[model samples]
Target: MKTAADKLSPTRVKLTVEVPFDELKPAVEAATKKIADQVQIPGFRKGHVPTRLVEQRFGRPAIMQEAVNDALPDLYQKAATEAEIKPVGRPEVEITEVPGLDGKDEGDLIFTVEQDVRPEIDLPDFSALEVEVEEPTVDDDAVQVRLDQLRERFGTLVGVDRPAEDGDFVSLDMTATIEDEEIESVEGVSYRIGEGNMLEGLDEALLGLSAGETTTFTSKLAGGEREGEEASVKVTAQSVKVRELPEADDEFAEMASEFDTLDELKADLKEKAEADAKGNRVALARNALLEKLLDDLEIPVPDGLVQEEIDNHLRNEGKEPGDSHGEEIREDTVKAIRAQFLLDEINATREVSVEQSDLMGYLQQLSAQYGIEPNQFLQMLAQSGQLEQIFAEVQRSKALDVVLADVTVKNESGDVLDLELGGSEDDADADDASDDAADEAETKPAAKKADESGAAEQETAEDVKAAAKTPAKKTTTRKAPAKKAPAKKTTATKAPAKKADAADEKDAKESGEKDA
Candidate 1:
């Protein structure tokens, strides 16, 4: 047993397990005695039958079967201990050598265990880690959009005598038929003209009918068992109504409640819109910051996980990930895998984790997005086989939040970005990162060129790698980097302007989005 472990690696090992024949002897004796008692012999009483006679009748196979069964469990335990393997699931045991009573009296048990080992990780300087997050800010434009939506909600529809038009509210009686056979009909249904919220073609059919007027039309139902099922609608419009937008004056405002004038409403709407926008940007930044922190990670993502991610992407893209999405899928999967790995590493290091309550909280937020109750939404997720996925997502999010607490966040301009929970800073970073890398590449051609290498380029590539790993600056705090000034300072010397600055001035002559 001592020598067995010496041959195996510390991380994983296999052992040649043996159960001595001496250990099997007692079990064999007990079995033979039991058999002798059960069987009747002509010369001896059934209980008094000799062991040798029982052995002769049953032979070695029966004795060995009993011995093997008795010894297997203890043998397996001894072997696993000897190998020092933390068996995750189960072992596939094979009897390598079976003990025989004669020359081949003793047999050895051998088996192999394949399992995932807890990886030994190399920790970096956690305190030195820095990340950037865009802060949430309420903007005027965002508020305006919200206000417009609100205004639309407050507007009322009143009847008009002209041919029914868009945004009109019409009260009508309707009937459906195909080939002069009446299939379905209804009366006095209040349908919004040009708002196709219900059955197909009904709104458009109602647009032309006025009070006391009727129009007949036929069209197919969009999606139904009766798809391609044609229906004729006879609409008698009891009323035709258009939006009666309230007057922008103070008296109408007083009628609407809470506001003195339309301007005040618009301002409030603008503020809300801006707040929403800022909140959106902040949320995006938080997510982006988390993703970037994960970007620095190096780990082998399991093929099963990547394949799963690819399949999901393909399903969402509404096409097979094979061939077309293969490359894209691989790239995305690797990034996703890295992100998850980094978050896991952080979780392990800091002991931060998502609990069941965190998962419930996450579900509540998701439910809010769809305007559904949390429990109903949870049931939907459970029924759809998505509970685990949702749980994982929640964990990832919680992990990111913890990461934000631990990391230093700054912007490209070197200004410290504010952190917001559940923000969308990632999209901004994605855009800005590309721009930064592109700009960096434009200035650092030698570095980029050195990265493209074959045998001849190996030495230079190594040099580039060496340089990249070394920290050039200690930029732990948020501060916008200014154009580097020349060392020889004059009494009133201007700074050496950046090449990008020149391009910017050139762009200013053209439109904001025009080519530099």
Candidate 2:
């Protein structure tokens, strides 16, 4: 057997393979037995028919074809290994020649395959890279913002006779109609002004409206039967109320937190804010490094992968392939794939592997984030078959850390900061899964943020539904609308795996070569 690869492009290859007839006899015999078990022959028990008899009935050409079809997978795998190419999708197999089928010659089986593969990357030196991170400085205003957020949790809405303002709570009745046909209506729903949790333009329309005032606005419905359709929504402002926060004092501190004094609470919040500032800096530095690397290097994305991802994104959003956002999604997908290849090359160079402890730590963090038990989270992941996806995330994160450790990070003040690579210290001596819960309590902020934000929220939601024995509770507090502004979230998007190679096996089964 011999296999060689020809580089067709940066992201594709053509593999040529030659397998002598001797190597194919096993597949031939296996195919013969398979056919014998399926066919009815007098005096010969099922699965016991001799190969010669089966061939005489089915013809030698048919037998050879079936044998070749059956053997393609293992042969392809071997060829890929010899060529040192990691294929992303099933190869397009072309059998150039087959042995002993024509009864004129018995020779090696020869085939060629064209497929997308992981591209070769010319990685830059990590040591030479320098990223400027924000100087770690937590102002009193930052701490006050956090303190205000905590205070809001314990605040009460007091009725006010004024126009609704930003941060004011409102009780409203809304009827949505498309062309005078009422599609949906809600009464006495509580909404915070400027929180665009509902339709696109509801917040803007709600502004400057007092109690008992009625207004109508046209906006695209967000969800339900009329999702994405334009609807004329008439809103009646039943009342306006403002959140009356408790005064920041010892008494309020005692009620809102475990701390007994306002000073203690402020001190704690300040400390947390500082830590968060550090985390933000770390995230920024790492991102700056990645951005620099991406800018400096020339990476070609596979066209097939980008289009496949684009189609998948549209499908998930219930939109057509030609959706307006298709080009934007394509650009992001291409960048993501390039980053994946670059990180993967670095990961390979560093011999990064997700240990069992690492995976458990990841699961623990996920469980805590979703407010479920670790066991329940594990069950959800297993049921949803995303355990590998999680594993891939942890591995890529560690790989990113490896790159971070090698690079030099400096703050704006020109001082070198001490950087801690998340999960690296305790990765060794991770003997107990039970201990992982405690270990994850100390994960670096950037790593934790990456884990939480890297995967789609829908994936976790689906998993939760599958794993929950009881239905999840319904809550009236609407999620604060996505900020009108895009937040700078430093997430290293890992490229998703192409559909499983099992499709290749199915293709072989359906080739009709076995019945030729």
Instruction: Give me the runs in candidate 1 sitting further than 4 Å from their true place.
Output: 1-109, 113-123, 133-137, 155-282, 308-328, 353-361, 368-373, 382-389, 418-516
- What tens digits encode model 1's per-residue C-alpha lDDT throughout 19-50? 66776667667767767778898999978888
What range of 10 consecutive residues in model 2 has the weakest lDDT sum? 485-494
The digit string of per-residue lDDT tens for model 2 on 86-111 reads 76633455667778676433688887
Task: Provide the RMSD of all predictions against the true structure, rounded to 1 decimal.
Answer: 21.4, 16.0
CA-lDDT, candidates in order: 0.47, 0.64
lDDT of 1 at 345: 55
Error of 2 at 245 (Å): 0.9
Candidate 2: regions farther than 4 A off: 103-105, 160-166, 170-241, 351-381, 422-516
